[model samples]
Target: MAFPLQRGLTPQEIEFLSEMEMVTVIPRQRLEGLELLSGPTEKLLPPQRATLPLWLAILLKRQRRVNIVPPHWLHPECLQVILQFETETKEYTDTFSPPPQLPGQRRAGDDSRRQSAAPLRPKYTLDGQRYYPTPPFLPQNTALTPSEASDLEREIALPYHWLEVGNMLLDAASDDLTEPDQVRRLLKDLREVRMSKMRKRVDALDAAAVAGGGVSLTGVGAMEIGEMRGFVAGVVEGLRKIGASREQARREQLAEEGSIQGYTQDDDDMQF
Candidate 1:
């Protein structure tokens, strides 16, 4: 499907965006890591645990030089507890209310609460592993524009919903799977199931949109619908392309095998 207007950043763009988020790390061995060659001649050294940008940390971790310290929100125990509660509770309601203020009045408690509520990083569970979602870029050094700050706040706030977070956590952690590989498989299955549901929903919406009418979902805007439709369509198309490519490869391999078998049979006949 051709998407005319620019909607949202692609997954690759999102990964590039999240590269600047700071993540905690503990060095496993003494090593000379990547140096900041341009700005400063500094390198991450071992024995001193430090917080570094996600991109740098990922590089070091891949090299087995550092161990990543996942944030508190990603803790399995905490996620599990949240998941259990979610399964038990039918409805969730927020109890905390914003502190009232008069004109020209600023309360310290209100400021603190606002700061606490508006977390810098938003957590999302993927394959039983929780991570903060990101967009194209969050400049580490430069000051954030008002728009950037608001975008960050919205991203952080969206995933903080108790019900959705809990459900995602539960989906990641399969009840019977203990082994890492098994749990990963379970998470993959769960993700596929969710994606299928989304695809079906999108199809329904697209059908409605095609049938001389359109439908509205609560909290979802027109722009969002277009973006989601594009995303889902992209995913489905990519999957189809991959499947076709694999099937073609399989067919060629089988044909070659058959040719070899026929050659062997002719050789045996000649010998007879």
Candidate 2:
């Protein structure tokens, strides 16, 4: 017996990839900076916050050397707002709540002035070429300052690795989060609500297979995509097979009609 081949990355693999996302951590002890393949880490000083990858943050938290600061979106109030947007908002009734705006992306009602005022800080490559970073490279999970947090409250959106990062922080640094229990509950509710919408949108998959048609997955997280990949692939494959069968039947019918017409024309010529 042959086993079915896997499509796309697994949830576990996606989770592992998410560990590379940068997060802010408040150190309880002093430590010297070390060079890593990605980049050199900042030296940790007592009570000073520094940005580190999620994997390193979790490791430090486990050793009681630092406390991970949860991102603004991970807060219960923010989660509540996001959940309401996903479930009750008329515009987003069928869509997932939008992900956080990318660098240099203006919000819905922003003016040109604001858009021009806030320029994106581009990262430089080893070759000194400037480029904008996305997802794991962006500091999406990093802790915000008080003023920054307040400003961000106006537009609450999850990051691409929201599920994986949230779970890791909750598991390793629950003490660092304010009302971790509520946060956990809200996360669960949000996941279920978004997943229900995903399932409902399966009817659109056939349309998505057609030219110029697609299902909007604007705010979908990495883990969610991984979870649904196999199911969506199966649905699309089945639809393609059905379409092929129908096309074959239509061609056969057309051929038979043409043959009958040709025979009639020959008989009419013979009669003439």
Candidate 3:
């Protein structure tokens, strides 16, 4: 039986797929995990039902690659699984106090004094590869042009919605499973999720604007799309590096000027 061969993945996604393509059977543990983190799919029509198992079998063509799971794998039932799970996670997290900081850790205040005094090694490791952001990912000291910075924002924002959906899906599935309901339940649940996300985003954007953060895509972060939080973290780390570098450079230049002026005055006063 023939399934529609959709367009091939983009070069970026293809590269990601290549690295992560060692597809193994969804382990029993993961399957059981999925049972909690993902809701059971609604029975598909004959053609629709056959796609996943088929895609799953064919997807194993690569042996030594890191497998990339597209965010949409939990589609059709997306609204039910992704959005509900996110909403629940946030509500649960808010009730808990934040974790305590460990001793010997430099707080932000102490760190400022030492920051420019030390060079930062902005290397991060993911799946064993040293991830230094060259263009979009920002990694550490990679300088970003204004356009490149804008591009980073675009790339990060693109994945936000998809991540939100995937996270919510995983969360919904994590709970104990009950008997499957009708398709309407899926649509209704999803609609509710979409609505909630919109409301949250609006509130966030408004707050960001009021706080002078420029255009803030607030709740759109780890709160909505739970799955891609790691990706978001990566982008954030990159931005942090960019900000730190600029600030460090500014402070260093100012300190150097102060030292130079002080020395010149002492030399003149001392006589020659």
Candidate with maximal lDDT: 2
TM-score, every prediction: 0.38, 0.93, 0.25
lDDT string, candidate 2, 31-63, tens digits? 999799998999999888899999998998999
The list of candidate 1 runs beyond 4 A from truth reads: 1-7, 30-45, 85-88, 92-179, 182-272
Candidate 1 C-alpha RMSD relative to the actual structure? 20.1
Candidate 3 accuracy as TM-score: 0.25
Q: Highest TM-score among the candidates is held by which one?
A: 2
Q: How much lDDT does each candidate structure score?
A: 0.44, 0.88, 0.35
- Tell me model 3's lDDT, rounded to 2 decimals: 0.35
Give the candidates in order of lDDT, highest first: 2, 1, 3
Name the regions of candidate 3 deviating beyond 4 angstroms: 1-224
Given candidate 1, what's the lDDT at residue 80?
45
Model 3: per-residue Cα lDDT at residue 71: 26
What range of 10 consecutive residues in model 2 has the weakest lDDT sum?
Answer: 111-120
Tell me how candidate 2 scores on lDDT.
Answer: 0.88
Q: Which candidate do you rate higher for TM-score, 2 or 3?
A: 2
* lDDT value, residue 160 of candidate 3: 24
